[model samples]
Target: MSTPTAGQLALADRIAHGGPAPVAAISHVAAAAYTDPARWAAEKTALFDRLPQVIAPSALLPRPNTAVPHDGFGKPLLITRDADGRAHVFMNVCRHRGTRLVEGMEAQYAPRLVCPYHAWSYALDGKLVGLPRADSFPGLDKTSYGLVELPSRETSGLIWFAFATDADFTAASAVGPDFDAFGLGGLHLFRRHTHDVAANWKLIMDAFLESYHVQRLHAGTIGPFFKDGVTAADKIGPHQRSAVGRVAELAALPPGDWPALRAAVTFAYQLFPATVIVVSPDYVNLMVLMPRGHDRVLVEDFMLIPEAPATEKARDHWQHSWDLLDTGVFGGEDFRAATLGQQGLESGAIEWLTLGTLESGVRHFHEEIESRLNTG
Candidate 1:
């Protein structure tokens, strides 16, 4: 494992000393923020569309000449790595007749993308390479007709893209060094599951931003493994990074031992806008929350491990971790709570939701959103 960052070590030092997690002033957010359609529309435009968004982990397209289709955010996108080992993002539609070029979510060894409708082909770098019946279209320039490319960057073992061509990606790049310390780019994709939750996207993101709900909401599943309401958090641009776990154990570990520290505490990251990375002792979970509407979200959950299983025992161990997180902890607890919260907020029983000091991360996340929406 890579060595821990100074920030991580500082958090551990605080935990060892029994220092209280930093607290924020009590705050409240309008209930309409989660229930109003207009607010949701504005957020999609200002945040999701304008800001750089995570496309997928770099491990998804593990090698050159590989491709995958992504529509999790409701926009058909194709992610590819060229033979020269460069990553690119383009509209999934074929330039000829606008037919969807790639159909599935799994990455494949695709040297070139071929349109199923008319056999029009495109290179991994989005160049239109071949087409049938060249005489049919005289003076047609293939170079000018390449797939529509989007602004994209591959950093810290992840792929990020933006809808706007002029979008600044500095905020997304800020989190790369920390992620690299966790070896995120070299991990293996163990499993992936999709959840269509009846809740706003922010609600789902709010769940990961704070550890206040981990003990109570997940009491039966993952609660016992974590300390009660003890967490340390800071921000990287609009992104929030938090740590929660056995404080005593973390405090006792020798300094600079990140692997041992990881085994004692769980690190969670809420990437700006709507992506989450949870680093557990043995594996990492990436959750991409795509807002479908004011009251709906599509969550793509991925579990990544250090390497492929080499034995049946290894496979069993990884399978157990996957089941505990994907099926029990997140699917059963976190998502269920988000959907339930949505139902209550929609009933008009309350005008605003009170946020306690422990939920400061959630409030900070909202403030970040408000800053962008008001300015944009």
Candidate 2:
């Protein structure tokens, strides 16, 4: 078995107990948090624009000179790996005319990108390499026309993009190095399920931050595996990790076999701003929430496993797992509730809603968002 990280150790202790202490009591959050248009715009600028956001798995660009184009957040962005085996991100636009360059996230092996607009091309490293009709434009220096490079890093098998090109945030500082415990770098994408949820991004996120609803909401699927309202949550800067213990299975083990507890619990990490990762015993499910409007969000669910299932039996196993997780927990229980909640809140029936002690993680997340918007 792989060695466990500090996070795993702390989680094991909490599983031995019932749960972690509640951080705060029941508190009321304004309804505008989900229905205000101006507040949504401010959140986009303060959170999405200023902070580093998880874009795609680093495995997407596996080989040198490979690239994937992403436009999830309304801006065309290119993520590529150079011949020298370094990762880079840049605005997917031609410097000459500002036309969009790449189209989709398809893998391409071209060493250079040619903009279809004016035949201008850029190297894999974002340097302007080919320009049609160079002499036609006098005193036009190619050195000053490279694609706009953004801050990017590959860590824990994921690619992160920060809009604040020069900021104090680092991947290690934000999520910590302990994520390697998941052996994420060794896993490959098994499948991806996308959903356009009819609710605010925060509302969708809040649904996953706590296991308080598992007993009542997910009782048919994941609820039976966990103890009700029992979770261990730890905040690592803006990022957070919460684990739900498996009561019967864990308690059945003898005290001497306690080290095996890692297999008896599920760990969830709230990677600041918009990504949520749930680490189960068999696989890891990553959710990326892109807020499209005040009451709309585009959610991408990436199912990762140790490797692509080679046999028919293995493939069937993973496929069944994905179906259950997608329909039962996320779509059926979580997003369904978020959509209904949005409808009620939009009706002006309530000015504010209260979160109880079991929902401390939700409260803390909202507090962080408010703090960033106020300070930024």
Candidate 1 lDDT for residue 47: 87
**Overall lDDT per candidate, in order of appearance:** 0.88, 0.82
Candidate 2 lDDT at 361 equals 86
Displacement of the residue 330 alpha carbon in candidate 2, Å: 1.6
Off by over 4 Å in 2: 18-20, 133-140, 171-174, 227-229, 247-259
Provide backbone clash counts, one per model: 0, 0
Residue-level lDDT of model 1, residues 173-261, one tens digit each, is 88888888889989998888889999999889999987788778988888887744257888888898988766668767888877888
State in Å the error of residue 184, model 1: 0.7
> Which 10-residue span in candidate 2 carries the lowest summed lDDT?
167-176
Best candidate (score: TM-score) = 1
Clashing pairs in 2: none
